[model samples]
Target: MSEQALSRDRVIRTLPLTHWNQPHHDSGALASLEQGNVLFLPHLSFTLMPEELKLLDPALVAPKRKNITFDPQHNRVRGLARQQYAQQVTDLLSRYYQHCLQLIDALLPEYRHAVHSPSNTLRLHPVSTWRSKSSWRKDDSRLHVDAFPSRPIHGERILRIFNNINPHGENREWRVGEPFPVLAQRFMPHLSGYSPLSSWFQQRIGMTKSLRSRYDHMMLQLHDAMKADRKYQEQGPQVTLSLPPGSSWICFADQTPHAAMSGQFMLEQTFLLPVSAMLNPQNSPLAVLEKLMQQPLL
Candidate 1:
């Protein structure tokens, strides 16, 4: 028998801030997210501390879309300290990076088990965005899933936490499409076989940060195929959510088809969750691919 399809109501849910930090894990909610669902948290309010508000002023920060990352490793702040990237502005924005991390950890379960202990690597992406008109890969205008050639996930899920922290009452607009399984079934036939040698060559020549695995190739193929298809990019099933400033949302980006239409000044946090921890592992890309290919994928 064919498996049951996920519904719109079951996929997207809105809940209050109180539901976030409960003692026990919400298995239903967790299942929804693991299976390409999105949590529309309009009531999740993140009020910046007075100091944070002053330091992270949108007017003061640099307008470069490619330079939104605020991790200490990125050194955007150090550049600020050295009178580069407008020292006064970048310094102010850097101060709030830690606070963004703390907020996401408190709000999501991707990092914690039912016992309330940390379970996964919470890779907080201190990305404050500004919409760009660059090439399709660099641009956020097209509908696509999140995948990086260098960051081969090896079947792990890409969970994301986003905050529409737009100042001046602006909203961060997004067009989120349906679940991944539907799209995968439609496009799987078109993707070419993954090449291990080619991937190794790319890593050796510094084309990728690391050796691209089969999972990486599959994700990259899915991303490119979906974006390149004009019909899917334009007429695909989707819903618009104009998230206001102070609101937050969470989703498994790797399994969800999405497009950023407009609006900016947003904070994004990324977390990696294991397929084994999922409420329904069969629903993940790793399991789905294994079923489709009639072999283990990861």
Candidate 2:
């Protein structure tokens, strides 16, 4: 591994992020995230009030990987929640979704961040209440970037908004790993080249979702590389953070290497931001990898 690759300054040139502790969103917030920084904000506490919580299905707070997912197309949330309480959950989710949408528009004026309609999947992860298994998809103990094998993101970025809603005053613990460029530098050379023929075959057989693009392929390879390396997992440079209840955060999960160490009762909203929204589109992972390889990536 090259020492230059591991240098923090050489990896990510991030802008200073402003913390939104109140009910306010700044346009700079979008730029900050585009620059690969995380912003912490005050949560929308009114969404899940105490009474609303009582009505929620036990599966939501249950010690497991159960959570209601909102379909943007159908405009509804589906989970193990009871039919009687379904309307309540649906109403809450509708408001919550609108709040997030307003937030993005307020913070990203002039920035062309087109969030695909109905692509947002809300997850209620009760990490503390659940037992974590070693399955690659289930285990978030190890630091890694957000990459989906079935969901080919192409060159688009994964912008995630997370809220720690632990009603009992519990905080979620997370470990932020090294910069994306640093990780890529360390793992890129070891990754095999993307095979177009294989991708076509997989897409033909329904093995790959929508056809795994080269960018997605590389991202998956990098994710696997970081997770498979035991030495890096134990001794990598990182910072641990405890996100308290009533707090929210925004980040490009694809760029930020993070690990869910502990804690639970978290609500997450996923969004896709286009490369054109960046202050400098060339700084994106797709462009960065292209520059590094001296060729087009996707």
Candidate 3:
């Protein structure tokens, strides 16, 4: 493989999340993360690579669909848990985690205990796909933060780890469409047990109208402008990432907006891992691991 490809492969092996001790706030790569970008890390020499990517595949990592409560309203969905996938991805993640702990230890040695026993959970999103030659605009999925109002305040810090299994560049490019304004207008009020159309009277009409009318107006304009630009192309239905096999990304769920594109001959799978402050605990073997990461033995 070319050096560039080799470098990419090395990065896949050494995920920043699993390897680095703590984020180098002073480094350009780590600083970008404060602005909601990922800090990619190269794999450690001792880390083991999965013989087959399928071992860490979302379908295999998670359990078969089971009825479970999701959403703030306790809405139900059938799916697997993070621990289920952890078993499959554990060795791979352990390598990355070890490195991450070291960084964290160096920066916050006093709080190392908290980093060890972090309350971690995993939830997987159902994989959806579209084939090639499909219309991209009509299929445009809007961009929005992943947070829900119903989740606990701390839950807001949760990072949703997305793993893409499709071969690189096989699917069309996925784009993050323009953000929508008037959040209420974008969602049907009736779905929330409020109906602007069926008001007690016209007294509330002005308020509802003001909020709902502006929905997606700005985004629609931006979309049109983009299409008019000479750079517009009928892209496929997939977002391409140069992630190596067994590699994953830690993204601030509520901060980043993501979506897949539309196109033909596309196959993609996704898994969600929830990383929280509670992963490390006050007293646990994991805590010991967290402390070890902080101190470098000379």
Best by TM-score: 2
Clashes of 2: 1
User: All candidates' lDDT scores?
Assistant: 0.63, 0.67, 0.32
Clashing pairs in 2: 72-118
Better of 1 and 3 by TM-score: 1
lDDT of 1 by residue, 3-38 (tens): 134344745776666434433345566666776878
Off by over 4 Å in 2: 1-28, 42-46, 55-66, 81-84, 118-125, 128-131
- Which pairs clash in the backbone of model 1? none
lDDT of 2 by residue, 5-104 (tens): 2444322333332332223345555556666666665444434766777642345432433567676558766663456666666666666666666656
- Candidate 3 per-residue lDDT, tens place, 1-298, comes to 0122112222222234443353433443333332344333323222334563444234432343311222211222223354444344444444334544455454324334543222222222222422232243432233333432211222213333333333332332333321122221223222222233543233354422322211122223233333333322223111223444334454433333334443222112112222333332221212222243343111
Better of 1 and 2 by lDDT: 2
**How many clashes (backbone N, Cα, C below 3 Å) per candidate?**
0, 1, 38
Per-candidate alpha-carbon RMSD to the true structure: 5.7, 4.3, 14.6
Sort all candidates by TM-score, best to worst: 2, 1, 3
- Per-prediction TM-score: 0.78, 0.83, 0.37
